[model samples]
Target: MPLLPTPSYTTSLLLSNGHVQTLYPPLFRKVAILDAERVRIATHDDDFLDLDFLPATAEAACPNADGVRARPLVIISHGLEGHSRRKYVRGMAACMNAAGWDVCAWNFRGCSGETNRALRMYHSGVTDDLHTVISYCAERGYARIALAGFSMGGNQILKYLGEHPAAVHPAIVAAATFSVPCDLVGAAKVLDRPSNSIYMRYFMRSLKEKMRKKKELHPELNIEGLDDMKTFAEFDNQFTAPIHGFRDAMDYWQRCGCGQFLSALRVPALLVNAKNDPFLSPTCYPVYTARASEFLHLEMPVTGGHVGFIRNHEDGCYWSDLRAVEFLRQHL
Candidate 1:
């Protein structure tokens, strides 16, 4: 299998560094207002995933009056601790909807504005929930389906595509992922850096809060040292690993990292990783593997940080969102 040419991605000169590019958009950019229709889908294990559907504009709607014109559908999976309503998620949904594609932005368990019934929370590698979401779309008779994921969600989608190469749904034509940390262990180490302490603090606050609530609901579950934990690695070791059945954080990262699965992807997929992204390690680039695989397209820009790919101050459109829609449209 021959490699696909590396795609080009231009970043804003003003948002020069990784942190500025990454933090600026979510904090300062104007959010797209969406009238989302929320739907709760029950999982096989009795837990539920909350999904928000945004239909295309009237001009972009299906040609058929019955709404069956082989309309393309895009399923977006948010990053860790991120819900469907996040500004980036809404921005992407709005762009796709305006381009004649129906968007389904689904939230991971315990992230849909409510605590999940089960003791387990979503992890970087968990793909069963994603499978369930895709299955739901498949059963609905969608003619073309594409996937777009951010950060941890990107890892899950890539892992799902690689793990189930032979079982991929016929309707799922392509995928696009942004700021993915393909190497889980490396990502944890990067996040533990002293300079990244602010990010770690922000994330831990949400994570610990969720755990505090989880402990309250499931008293029978053994989760000690929740208060003393400081780093992400520590929290994963204490809770994310054992509660989800891994021996420890290292074990979970080794077994679940998506880098090990990229070579097996059978569907066309675009992976965009900014070289300056604060959350990624060198291994996350996967340049060699992408060059050898027929289906994978790797795009590494010099500046876009984390999930931030803001093009410029004047035009608020994110480079990732536009590129994702463009790539998916090519396959459609």
Candidate 2:
């Protein structure tokens, strides 16, 4: 199938209240974006803190007119092996901040190259940490909260909303997830395809290195048989599943998969995905499940290349970040 055509972005959106409103300019696309500066908020010693919170500082170029405290909080979640410093994350943060929202990008456990100290590593369905982050925001009196996640982070956000619909605090008004892996097992198969093996190798190398680092801290971590494991399934079965307390990769996929969670999501959500994403096959697309949810708005763009939606042409303008901002503006 040909890739989904890229959509044009406009500033105006029609809201449910029968009013058309203009969103802030997409300053994030213009700015060079910022490098991540880390801040350590809490230690794992506290009951709520399992890993140190390394919140990335915003570029400050897109300050909200409503003042920092009054704006809605936009929480960004990065994909596997990615940190808050990624250019896309920074771009998204800048867009949200420009749109009168305070933005914070979260670094998953051990993702910022810091050892988590805990035996368990972060997984796609790990929503407790996200909940804690939301609580931190709520306590600071940010009455409105929204989320945007890339890839694995996307999977986590959808799962989080579904798993804790009733328990989610009132502050979280809506969310947007991009390039999500709706079916992990099916996605694993896609990654194993000849066309996508390069991506598979890249991800597995990072994952294996993390495991190797973990093995260094604890000699008896039992990673002896994983040297030849090339597939995502093999890696997850050996490391991700066992360490995270799941029975196996299939069990993890079955429980953590986000496709089944669409029906339960009450908040307005924009799920943007790429049909050509290397991590997922055609079967991995959750079109049917997404269509079932009145609250879910799905956008499957043709390109993007597994969150690599730089959207720049041979010369001049690009539109991925702008489109993302526009989608959020329309929904939230």
Top of the candidates by lDDT: 1
Clashing pairs in 1: none
lDDT of 2 by residue, 115-154 (tens): 6766787888888878877877666566777888888998
Q: Residue 250 deviation, candidate 1, in Å?
A: 0.4
For each candidate in the order shown, give its overall lDDT on alpha carbons: 0.86, 0.67
Off by over 4 Å in 1: 1-8, 58-69, 313-315
Q: Specify the poorest-scoring 10-residue window by lDDT in model 1.
A: 60-69
